[model samples]
Target: MKQGVLLIAVLTLNGCSSISPQECEVGDWFAIGKTDGQQGIASSKFRSYQKECAEHGLGSDFKAYEQGHAEGVLLYCTYDAGRELGQSGGAYNKVCTGALEPTFRLGYDRGRKWYQAESALLNLQKTLEQNAGTIEKLEQRIDDNTRELSVLKDKQQKQNLLDENRNLLQDLRQLNQMQGQLQRDLKQAELQFSLIQQGG
Candidate 1:
């Protein structure tokens, strides 16, 4: 029963970890650490690997892993890497230090502004599209109601239709106002995005 429980625990840990059971068996700690560092993964990630490997009765080489990670992190902590990451809306882990941190952060900040401007423009465009679609639907509904009212014989039903048309017309006016506001917002957003694209 104890062995079965241990096996289950190992399996569960392996499932949660990116490191496979086969990787634990092979025990290439340095390479794993290097890959993680190059990807800007946190130092705490090593502890997770330790735990997963320990569950499988394997030993990890911390010294070798740390050495490899130090070298790999140099490659990750670059201006180009930071710019690409920020442009893609990736989160920074604050892994870079000292002089490296400043350079990377400068690129990251610039790219982040561009990304935000682009995102704002896209959101405004989407809202404008939705507003236009709603306005079109409201107009269609009002027209249909008007047509039905023209040929109606029941007085009570005709009154209900008239009331509904009034509400629909009010809604349509509000939606048109919203559409105009969205268009103005979209134009501003587009101008901001264009400025960012031009490196302003």
Candidate 2:
């Protein structure tokens, strides 16, 4: 029977230790590198493995790791991948170089613009709903006050209530106007979003 060695080192980087002892013992450097590359991690990530492996008196296969990483990054440097990253608001790791960077950046920009348009549309809708609630509350108040005014026999009190109701009406009109403008804005955002989707 073969015995497994415990290779864990309680070494910390930025307040956390990333690799377990079993990872060091298995020494699957190619797979590790491929994963990091696909995830768009920077080359400097290898230092973390180097530091951990050194603690266990082992060394990494740098040539094999780099070879696998180079292959894996090819998939990460695609248009759809870039767009997905942008839509998720994830940062680019700046791993793609030379021939790939320009195309990926273009896709990222398009996706980010789409996300912004969607966000703007939602905000406009929320504002419109809030305005509607405010208008409802104001209308309810006006109705209550008008009912009270109708039964009042005192001339001065009835006149005051009438003036208050008039003010409420004016406020309701302004809110309606603002709501109209927000609706227009929402339409424009939706149109822009649709255009983006069509273009993509």
Candidate 3:
């Protein structure tokens, strides 16, 4: 059992390791760094690579890696890249510097705002759907209980069903009012999302 647990742990660690044994042997530190930078991965990730490579008795070239990363960062820090990342709800690593940072941030913020507006509209729509479904269920239950009440011969059972139906009707009325309000809110959210889409 202990051996099995140890084997599983080793397999899990190997699966999660970013660098493979073959990659460590090839020692393409520059390309690895460039890829990380292009993906907006943090500089600290190099330490993780170092640790993993060390396990394979390999050492990384920091100078070559840094040079490659700087070049790759230039490609990653564009306004369009930032906008696309923000739109996809991706986090910024604050990698862009000097002149590049401002434009990237501007695009990211605008895209992020649009994303938030769209998310809000979707949430409201989902709530409206749930409210309508609940109202329908309550109405159906009230109808079923009313029919059962009419056919029930026992006095106490009939009275209990009547009470249950009365509560259900009250709940249905409240839900109807909520549904109306949700419809209004949805319309407003839709208008807001439209405005955002139009860059208003």
Query: Which residue runs of candidate 3 sit more than 4 Å off their true CA positions?
Result: 1-17
Candidate with the greatest TM-score versus the true structure: 3
| Angstrom error at residue 186, model 1 | 0.5
Model 1 clashing residue pairs (backbone): none
Model 2, residue 169: displacement in angstroms? Answer: 2.7
Per-residue CA lDDT of model 2 for 100-182, tens digit only, reads 88888887888788787778888888899999999999999999998898899999999999999999999999999999999
Per-residue CA lDDT of candidate 1, range 104-159, in tens? 88778878988899889888888888888888988999899999999999999999
Q: What is the lDDT of residue 27 in candidate 2?
A: 67
* Alpha-carbon runs more than 4 Å astray in model 1: 1-16
Measured by lDDT, the strongest candidate is 1
- Would you estimate the TM-scores of all the predictions? 0.84, 0.78, 0.85
TM-score ranking, high to low: 3, 1, 2
lDDT for every model? 0.78, 0.77, 0.77
Error of 3 at 169 (Å): 1.3
**Stronger candidate by TM-score (2 vs 3):** 3
TM-score of 1: 0.84
